[model samples]
Target: MKHEDEMRRRAGAESIAGGDEAEQLDQDTLIHELRTHQLELEMQNEELQRTELELIEARDRFTDLYDFAPVGYATVSDKGLITQANIMLAEMLGVDRNRLIGQRFSHFIMPQDYDAWYLLIVKLFRLNLRQQTELALKCEDGSICYAQLHCLPVCSAQSNAIRITFADISEYRRIEAEKRQYEEQCRSLFENMLDIYYKTDMDGRIEVVSPSCLAQTGYTQAELLGRRVTEFYIDPAQRDQLLSALLRKGKVNDYELILAHKNKAPRIASATCRLLRDEAGKPVAIEGVLRNITARKQVEEQLRLSETRYRALFEQTSDYVLVMEPRTDAAPVIVDANQAAFEKHGYAADDLIGKPITFIDTNISPEAVAERMRLLQSGDPVYFETKHTCSDGSTFWADAVARYVSIGDSNMIYSVERDATRRKQAEEDQARLLRENRALMRQLMQVQEDERRTLARDLHDELGQLLTGIQTRGEYITMHAIDSEVRIMGEEIVRSTSALFDASHASLLRLRPATLDALGLSAALTELTGERQKQADIVCSMRIDGDIDALDDMRAIAIYRLVQEGLTNAFRHGKADCVNVIIRKLPAHAGRDDQLWIEITDNGKGVHAEADRTPTGMGVIGMRERVHALGGTFMLTHVPEDGVRIEAMLPLDHSEDSGR
Candidate 1:
């Protein structure tokens, strides 16, 4: 604007001087000079008008921005009286713009801030430098607002006015209060919880310590603060690495570690760490919690030790170790049994599992086991046992200890079995050994019983028949060539001989059945059981399923012997009116056909072995060893209502597979 004014004045002065220097004035010359001077003046006036309009538009734009700024903006005279104020500042003060003008700022300031405001004004006047202050202002409505005000001397000395811009912080203050309340609640919780909580900077310095950490680590907050986290770690390097990982991954959980506390003792703890990131996703700090798991760690160690000690003990155990569950169905079902449990009771783990415990143990009746199942549904526990049968039809002794335990939070029954087969077998073998044999003494003690049976059968077949033939000849002679009295005596002799032979033959067959060798086990079992069926033929049929050709002789022999013993118990001892025997190959898996199964089922009086302890029985113990000798399993089941079932499984691990 100043440049335009100067140019207009120079042009006017030059034209006036040119006119004064002219002497002759022709009509045409005079007209041209006047018109040129008029044009110059008009151009100057237009230039001045354009400059004025431009200045007005620029001032209006600035004024609008100043009044409409988000923050409170104002201008004041040197005397601290308001010269101009934005609508925001005017509204904040609960005053109209017209009313706010010319008012002294000190009138709107809170009483407590009067001295601060005075000091700020003095600083701005003296130093002519920009300054900022936080102060409270009392609005016309009697409400107080927090603000950060920055003031600077904007105009020259002559103008003597100050420009101020400020930010209102009332909303920020409210949010801070809420956050502080939340932190206090968290602090209270940390002070009482059994778990430990902590926070750290990105550099691994422990910045915040929860009160629970004191109880867990015996360290004071002051002792922990600003300290490198590695200082308290049992493995300092591990601790450093974990912190670095948290910074990278943003979060980690279930991290196991050992920490040395103030007492200098290491405590096993599981720690979780989470990173606090900035808006840019870069880690700023870490927060985490820890739980002292020393007890659980100790338990794990003890279990490992137990397994080592029990490795050899499994073979030598006097009592069977059974993992059995009670019954299922309308009755109780035996679920699972270990090697020893199955050996003592004559069953396999797979056979017994998923069934009721009653299938094997008979200590508790089927009805009782059913009631106990109800108890389990109500989260209660019960104890019971039952007898079981093997696939080859053998019985066994077993004892179990069972109780409900937790896997995490789910409930499950934990059973440990102590096999009592050896003890019972030792007693039986001792009682029966001396009466059986001499040269075949210790080793032949078992075979002697079978030999006795064979001898009886020989006597019945050979000697008894010879005597009967002789008696028949004699009777014929008496009737034809002698007297009536002699004939009667001969008939009596023949009848007595027949009775004696029958008993001896029956005993011989029981000692050892020769049919076992003549035919496969399935055939032998069917024939042997057919004889028993005449007396106890409550069951309709007995059958075999699945491929059974891969079994070795010993395994076959074991199964056959088991079946003989099992049938005796089911028919003669168990008073079971009905029984079913099943022999089959196991489920076919790819590259696996090493398993064969034998199952004997009966609905009769159950042998209730105490679930808490092993019971006695030679058939049970013998069947157990036989199955075990083949590197397989034996398990027994004593059902709640349905009676007892026994299963024996053997693995032909050496047999070649067809990859079927």
Candidate 2:
């Protein structure tokens, strides 16, 4: 349109120039031509004015488009200053449009992004082509935003500047970063989780598998992908069953299957699966987690076998077994019983099934029933001796042991009753025999004491006196002899008589120590210890506590004999170097009346191990019998690396004494 106006203007000017020669020929024609020229100029001026208005409108449109564009546009001078900044550019920088003019563009760039911006600008000018870069830009409010800058170098005759267009891409970059992080997390879970995660296509061909599949199925991701899922199953039918379930239910949980490993070993697995469908809701693939359940399956099998064995034992045992359920009223109700139980009670199985457990027990008193209830409530076993009545109206003793047991979900009492009638009778018989034997033993011990006293008296009176008289006669003969040979014969006779007297005295002491009857227990023990020390050349010490002299004859005699036997054992058998005897009166305490403690210790080579292995020796048996007969406790211990010790505790009160 401008070119057409310019052509018309030039043609008018040429026409006027050509008409100047015609004006000299005719004045009137010249005036008319001037008038036409004037009209033409007026028309030309109107056209020019209209064209100027159009140009102004177009310029306004261009300015508005540049300023309101989605992207920020700016012209930057070679010095990195902003020569022109549109409204979007000012808004992107968080500044007013007028405030951005002549401002250094580099000021808006983050310090860390300065180098990138500088290099970008340099490249844009050096290549004189469009160059782009992403950088963090600082806004007027000190906030940071990520942006992509596209720059085109503008080098013209009038000015040298770069036109740059940038967009605020902070939100896009933020979303991209979040997406990357989510992908990383998902990848981590897929690779590191223990259970097998897999995806399959509609055809049952493996589409993808996690790294864990390698460990779960002994097949790597590479090996499993693109392969048929049924190929790994021990029975392909199992896969078919799984697919059928998935198709029918749209999902399956804890579905058991057997899959074969690379080594051809069958593995038990439990799978939880769901259908993966498209937008059309058609099942495209199956997604699931498969967990190894081999251990659980093995445990289940073992439990099944164990239950079988337990059932066999429960049915076949000879001891009567009763399974009863506890009730609020009366005793427990007998729910079931073994054949032995019915046979022992002389009742048909039907007769006892619904009856209370107390019906079979002849002596189930209220207190007994209460006690059993208490034990059951506390989850403890009940063990007691009770008599059970049979159908014949006769009763027998039974040792019943009942415990609370849980079978499935029901709580019941499992009882085993053994026929204890024979055992109880045998125990009574043994007790009677033991009493009779103890009575006979006491009588025998008394008789033995009498015989020993008599023998000791004979040796002391008759044999001792006779030996004394012979020694006296021999001594007189030696002193009054008239010849030396007769004197020598008399001296030899005296020596032999003296030896006989000594032997008789020693024998009398062994039979019954005279001091025991004459001077009480302490004096007798002192005398006995003295004799052992002298004979064995051992150091013997005695500690007699309390008033031992107050003891009666029977106790004194027993104590004297016990000490005599202990010292003799220590000196003769133990070959002890020192003997210690302690007799102290024990004060009465709860559960124990006043007692006497006699402890004898010897520093000797400890008692031989073989001696312990022996069932009984005469000396030890005699000591134990004497102590037990007096209702006392006796202990003989050979201290390791030390010596032998014999201790006895005899109750002072003889009211409960079995020996008497």
Candidate 3:
């Protein structure tokens, strides 16, 4: 300001000294213009200062946007060093921004992606245009991230660098991989599935056919595609019907149709279809799955025929066949009956259909029927005999076979019955005749025993007295003496008479045991056993329990004979070392009479030595007949250990007074 004042004063003096009024006016005007110019310069300076402050604010905003931007940004020098990196880029590489600057950017590139990154940089600088490439980027923690890099080359006064933007594309790549895998799976199913998949246009022309169509229809893809679908149908009209249904319902499930194969054989197929429509919702094509059901249909036909045949056999059989439902709480209820059953029972089918089985049964109780059914539950059949009453009140026996059958969900009893009346009647008649024969045999044996007793008595009365007299005379002769020769003759005669008397007495005892008539059955058995043991040189034992002596005379004699025959057989045929006899009387009880039990066992080689052990001999026959005649049972069986045992149970009828 002082220098300008000095310069103005000096210029003022010079203009005054020149003595020109016009020059002095020009100096004053010049001074006014100078001052206005200075004012304009000051205003411009203030405007510049305000513009500088606005520029600083804008720079701060831009820096904030760059640091916080979602995309990772970086600047790489031509040497591949990171000259600048945004906060996002630093975070992407898992490094601090301060540590990221001036670092080799290639270090963050994955080993496998190094070449790609190098090529990308080369291409960016070579073209000097925006370039993009995908790379796998590695973080400091060794984790991988997929990124697409968009790079642009930048030139500055100091050096050249590449500006790059990183986009994370890991999720996009993962979705692409999953889509490819899903397509492959769909392709595999279409090619390898057993059922046929197909598509047809509105004109019934085949459009798409899966590979399985060839195996199911006997037509290759070339022959089937672009062909009319109805041409394969046995009845072309059926295709129209199916299409109409599909259009109306939007879908059809499990529709059956017959189609002609390439070889002219008929094929059964089950189809499930949907109507495929255009954007306007108008039906344009049909898509469906077709499954070959020829084998299944054939099996069903065979089963139907088999069932028909079984029904025929079940109805036409001669034997009475009936099916019944068994119940635990009641008798079995009849479910069905064949023609024979209806006729035999003299009832119409309607009458017996819902009736209990006991309706026709005469003697079988419901409990017994239930028991038989229970036994049949083991999956085995049961055979039984029962009597049934006819409509006329006459009963007849039936031989029945029953089986438990499970059909579907029902438990039933199937029974076949045949008339067994005649057979049972014959068995009864034979049994009665046998009883009569045994009665006659008992009478004959009684007669024989009486004659033997009479003979024994006669022998004891007349012959015994004569034998005694002869023995007495012999003694007298031995006591007296005469001439020597006469005396010798007398001694010889005495010896002979004594021997003859002894012989007569032995014969009498053999004919009839006097002990039996005098001492009762117990003493009789003892004497008989003793004599047999002494004669046979064998061991013999007898056990008589209860009051056997209380038996009637006839039964007592029978008991004696039984023991006698048993011992004789043991010695003669059994070749036994020992014989055992047991006899006991059983007291009367409910449904049974007073009885005698006799058992004869021997330790001898069994009757198997003589072939079968059946009682074919007369002695054995006599024993059985006597027991049976007295309404008893007889068994002659081989013992476990090389012996035969005879067991007899005889009912006693006491016609005489008890001797107990």
Against the reference, the lDDT scores of all candidates come to 0.71, 0.83, 0.84
2: Cα error in model 2, Å: 52
Model 1: per-residue Cα lDDT over 1-660, one tens digit each? 454455456556665665744422333454565677778879999999998999898889888778887899989898889998999999878899999999998888999999999899889978989999988888899999888899997658477888999799878877888899999987778788788788888777988878777788898788888998888788888887787677667788889998897889999999898989889988788889899999889999999999878766654566554443332465534444446666655556666667655455545675766665676566545454434555566665544455655467554565555444576688678745532322233224336545654675677578777877876785675567566787777777767766766665565556556565556666667777787787566662577776453455555556766787777667655678888888777675897655787888888776554321223335666666556545567898877667678898877664321110
lDDT per residue as tens, model 2, 1-660: 454455456555656676966444455544566667778888999999999999999999898889998999999999888988898888888999888998898888889999998888778878898899998999888998899988889898987899888898999999999999999999999889898988899788988788998777788888888999888888898888889889999999999999898888999999999999999999999999989999889999999999999778878999889889987767889999888888889999889999987798857887778778888777778788888899999899989888987768788888888999999999999987776776676567778778889999988898878888888988999999999999999999999988887777667667788887787777878888887788889999999889878875556667777787787777767878998999999889998788899999998876664543223223766777777766678999987657889999988886764443
How does residue 335 of candidate 1 score in lDDT? 48
Model 3's lDDT to the true fold?
0.84
Score every model by TM-score: 0.35, 0.55, 0.61
Ten-residue stretch with the least lDDT total in model 1? 434-443
Runs off by more than 4 Å, candidate 2: 1-185, 216-219, 227-244, 257-269, 292-299, 319-435, 454-508, 531-539, 570-578, 602-620, 635-644, 658-660
TM-score-better candidate, 1 vs 2 = 2
lDDT of 3 by residue, 231-317 (tens): 999999899899889978999999999999999999999999999888999989899999999999999999999989978988899
How much is the lDDT of residue 540 in candidate 3? 96
Which residue segments of model 3 deviate by more than 4 Å?
A: 1-238, 244-255, 260-265, 270-281, 284-293, 481-512, 584-597, 606-617, 638-643, 651-660
Point out where model 1 deviates above 4 Å.
Answer: 1-461, 464-468, 471-482, 537-540, 547-551, 587-593, 608-617, 629-631, 638-642, 653-660
